[model samples]
Target: MTELRHRGPAETDLQAADDFRGLDKDGAPDGDAHSDSEAKGDTGLPDVPVPPDDTPQVLNKALSGLSSRWKNWWVRGILTLAMISFFFFIIYLGPMVLMMIVLCVQIKCFQEIITIGYSVYHSYHLPWFRTLSWYFLLCVNYFFYGETVTDYFFTLVQREEPLRILSKYHRFISFALYLTGFCMFVLSLVKKHYRLQFYMFGWTHVTLLIVVTQSHLIIHNLFEGMIWFIVPISCVICNDIMAYMFGFFFGRTPLIKLSPKKTWEGFVGGFFSTVVFGILLSYVMAGYRYFVCPVEFNSDSNSFTVDCQPSELFQLQEYPLPAVLQSLTGWATVHMYPFQIHSIALSAFASIVGPFGGFFASGFKRAFKIKDFANTIPGHGGIMDRFDCQYLMATFVNVYIASFIRGPNPSKVIQQLLALRLDQQLQIFNSLKAHLTERGLLPANEVAA
Candidate 1:
């Protein structure tokens, strides 16, 4: 009985040791299996964790531990709302502030793009690249801004003797400045890095073409009318937001390889939502002269004004309905703003073509293997990232204006005439009178005067 008892205790100890070892082995595999399942779940989507540098100051590290999806939504929503609020505030502040904002955005975008080029070509140690890029930017800005000032604020230009002289020789001065930069770039080129220097030269010029030129067009749109800027921009913003909302909920089929998360469902949903939003926003803005009137400097007020009579595009007009629609709705006509009709075109472009701009940026970034252009805006990548579609929309608006909306500016013509030499002005005046007389548009008495 004593021997049996001793054997039983030893058997129990052996069994306990085996169980302990088994638990260690089995537990390890179980943990590994759970991790494998998680990795499998995340196979398609990239692990885009927020970098330490890009994280917001408001968000504590503890909050950063939240799931990526939640963090994205939180950051995106907060920034979007803040941006919208700031947009309205700027609008209320008036056109001057808006112009300043556009200028700042342009400079920032230029910096971001130039910085990219610097980083990419840094290996070659190209000399004076950054300086040449900035010099070119300055040259371009001077040329464009001078033209804009001469065109839109002729009164102010004429009142100031220095500005008048500058405006008179603006193009020549701009050319001289650009030539100087070109000479400097050429002088700075080293024999060893000639190819690298030339490559960077092309890069700088292309970046200027994309960033500066498009931004100049945006300024033109803003001057034509606030509506030209606000409506198109709002359409893009609405589309971007709705696309995300739709995609988050119902996205399945990938839209493009460049942007895998983009889906056909989101694209379609954004289109309809943007169209509706554009039309409604246009309708409301049409009623406000502040939104519809072209920006003009007022010497008397010593400030800019949006006080001109609203253009025909902003006017309300009634159109007779088709017979089928009239029968169905019992209405013979519908009143609508022509600008609202144009908004459809704007929204359509913003919806259809605008996203391509974003895709192109995405492809460019992927080529460089960079996540975002710069961490300018939290959760939104950078200013360049947000404004990619906007730049495209701005170009469209400028083209549309030139094609359909722009008319001969009497003030601009008069300013040009006034800038001429006295003899030249008199000769042109006489020629105009003679032409008018031949057409029987000028009375003999007025012609003599």
Candidate 2:
């Protein structure tokens, strides 16, 4: 009996030992297998996260995000409008106040430029002193000699009043300018691996940016002849509205890879609508006080502005044509176009390049993997981000017109028949631009008279 019991217990112990070893060997391998399955994406689950016929909330979530973004846009727009209103209030009720406001806005704009540059090409170090000096130079060049610089360009091709003097001083002036510029470049290399070229480029861009933005605004205000500011702003707000509506409904094909949301359909639709509205708006404004003929002369000698007698004959000191062309300013055409080519080129540029400016900014955002430029606006980003395209658009439009069209380039038939002076012709050219930019905008006359 004792022998049989001992044998039975020994058999039981062997069975238990085998079971323990088997588990030890299988545990690690099983774990390894599970990990491998995970790595291989073998979820052993359904292909779709939710059924193809899932609840609306799945899609609703995406829409909800979009709506939230839109909501912020509205809030920002209202605030911006309110701020603009106050600015106008001061402009009319307080011209002095307008000066301060413009200065502040200009400075903030400069800050944005520097900040953006630093962000993108972070490798460069632009000292504060350089930036400040650049700003000072820009201010002097733009504000003090705004009209003079413009005249210089428009009349550059004209026979010089002092050709002999220019010839006499040409070499000396060239050497002086070259020496000064060279010194600046050499000084730029003073810092460790200093980037003088970039420094100059940055400064030049800043100067041009400020000049273009402010000068155009000033000229626009002058052209509109309005102390009431709503005229220009109407275009901006209307454009944003039209762009959004059109883009939402017809944004089928992506306008660009950087801004996938923007579509060709929206761009074309929005632009057409804006143009149609602008024409109507300009027509309505034609009868307003600000829309009066430039020759109306303010009649008041104490008027702050000079008699901006619209040039006749593309007339010059040497070729002083009859004053008959003066009547054509606002009386004949919408704006002035000294030459047709200049006007058309400007329009084409603003339409294409302007949009690309926005695209360029979008590319930058995508590179950084960010949604917006800043949280300042709900749907839009910062003022700089949102208006960067417009800034370039407005400037280029003006430059293109002033440079090419505001001259005596038109065939004699068109000039004599139309009796349109170069300046008046250019204005007509500008009218097209105005038409594009001023979709929902009120005309100067409507705001005033």
Candidate 3:
């Protein structure tokens, strides 16, 4: 009896030790075997979602014979070529069309992002949320485009009494409209859903900041010169393409945790390729009056025109090579447009820093467990996906111009002077004439007049 009792207690002690170690009585894992494998496989990051097959039936049928991987490649390639072709067509259509396209794209991108918020928060049934979001969009657009119209089309605004009045009170009107939306939002807030409603309120404003504000800057860049808009944008596109090609073929090492597929090899290749592309693209565009000239509104024609003498930056100038480069290349001087040097700066930013915008969008989508912002574009995702980097580039170009490139615009000053009362205009004219005469710049006869 004593021997049996000792063995029983000893066995109980062993059983308790096994339980402490998370093992069953049989000396195996206590839980599901698959759960152990899952713990082993946990990466502390979300799995990258596979893109859905949203291609058209016709294209789908054509690609049906191929494997899924090859089919995706072909679909992306064809759509990419088509988008590029359409882009060229719009550029040919002129600035007005381009501005309209930008507006449309802004609206579409806003919708895609807002729709995602709706899905994530289950706010479809929420009162006044969607309406207020769009109201805010309208209010912001009015404020931005209103300022643009006043700045660029001031002559037209002056001729129309209503537009003139609106231009003068644009800011006040924008604020009033936004205030009305705010009041409505407060009224719409529910007791149980207060937190979610506030979350969505923040989401809407951030979306506006991202979409509308950057787009406004893009329009400003366009007005400076189409080159300001196009070159930066093309640099981003070129970098995107080159990086993808290099990564697809040569990438072995990962570059970032946010985007697993990105690689250092692709990043380096894209940088060099984009720099060369920017230089050549700038060379071609610099030679053209249409591409280099600032967009202006002609009062007589009542339409926009881009016709100005090529700026010195566009003209070819001889630059002396550094001693190191001179000896290596057997060249004393190199003839190139000054703008090409600027292009190197733009291209470097586009290639090196621009990808972060895309990475940010990636993180956002991952947080929401979404594959893409929307299925608006087959094989490419949404308009936001394509233009995320472009928006960042636009802001950079705008700041660059204001800081380094923009000078006193004589014509703009003249337009502002013309908009003043007759007496005020005369006062300014007299002041300028007096200053110029003192400096011996005004002719003797003209100064007397």
Candidate 4:
């Protein structure tokens, strides 16, 4: 009261005025604005406010001493070696474990992508979107798993009556389950958020297309042979590491705008390194039946075995050298695995085209104004981040195998035969018998029997 005679306002009133001035025109505090700033800070965005020097340690002292770029490279190298070792261990463990790993990776990737959608569209409070997303994932998985089981384990499925029934109407059942989820989604849509709901629907489908579809192809590649799964993946890993190393040491010209750190130097270095690594790895893997042979169910052992005679693709052959090389090398041809030739294509794509997948992911992150997909892999971002290029590579390998490598699968044909009705089966059996008899491929007694 002694000094209030001349004071314009009390301290509390001045503080309230400052707070009011900080708010938006709607009179609500700009909490979202501050939240964004904090998120940027957490993600290490350059413009965000940095913590004070007195702030407590967040990272380990050993890691904290290194610059961010060095820390990223160091962490990536360690993770890469660990992952490579883990992959070999899984391969040794068998196809079932490898299939489970693929499934786990697919689920994690789908989760990361769908989580992004939820974050972006969360304010609209779209009903049943998450449920519908997971439901569709389940439905698609059922459809894919059913197809896989029918193709690879038809005998096992037929031995069990319940499984045989389920296998018969698998597609119809999957459709029905998906339709139920679709109906629930439709019923949950709010009138006010109709546009947002539809937008999220598209988002969910796109995510499925990108993540689940590619992952399914990866599984198909795995079943084709461990080489199909391993070589391409290893090539990609080699390219990634070599590219990073080259870029860190001598990157000058930028390769792409989306990923600023990518350099032409890195790209070229990675390509050569990947091709060499792929060929060498293919040579080594081709020697082992475990890597070169397709996975097949062994009913006697009740376990999968990679015991088929190695395909011509996996066998060593002498490829004739070109005129110029023949003169220089004093050799007409070089002995090498045919699979090694295919590995070149795989490695080339991993270098040339696979990077686009990473760029696409980068652009997506930029559009969303986020740093990493998620902090799922420390310093490496998410599993999605690591596998983005791998997925693209997997799709290419699957297509390549279908186009140039794969022949009619005998087991798949048997599965189709088993699916036929009794009348249809007899018709095919008689027609085949007649054709074989006419061609003199079957004995008269055998045909009659």
* lDDT-best of 1 and 3: 3
User: Candidates' TM-scores?
Assistant: 0.84, 0.49, 0.85, 0.84
Highest lDDT: which candidate? 3
The CA lDDT of each predicted structure is 0.83, 0.45, 0.84, 0.79
How many angstroms is residue 100 displaced in model 1 relative to the true structure, after the best TM-score fit?
A: 1.0
Q: On residues 1-449, what C-alpha lDDT tens digit does candidate 3 reach at each position? A: 13223444335344434533557545667554424524554221223344576789988999999998778778888888998899899999988888999999999999988877665345225687778889999999999999998988778898889999998899999999999989999999876556556777998999999999999999999988899988999999999999988887889989997788899999999999999999999999999989999888887897889998888999999999999999999999999999999999999999999999999998777544667887778888988989889888989999999999999877778878888999999999899898998888988688767
Best of the candidates, TM-score: 3
Error of 2 at 224 (Å): 8.1
Instruction: Give the per-residue lDDT digits (tens) of candidate 2, residues 243-340.
Output: 66788766788877667778888777766655555544443543444332221122235233323333331222232233575455433323422322
lDDT of 4 at 386: 92
User: Which parts of model 2 have CA positions greater than 4 angstroms off?
Assistant: 1-67, 80-106, 119-185, 195-237, 292-300, 305-353, 364-379, 399-449
* Model 1 lDDT tens row, 212-250: 899889899999989999999999999999999899889
Lowest summed lDDT across 10 adjacent residues in model 4 is found at 42-51
Off by over 4 Å in 1: 1-53, 60-66, 421-429, 442-449
Clashes in model 4: which pairs? none
Q: Arrange candidates by TM-score, highest first: which order?
A: 3, 1, 4, 2
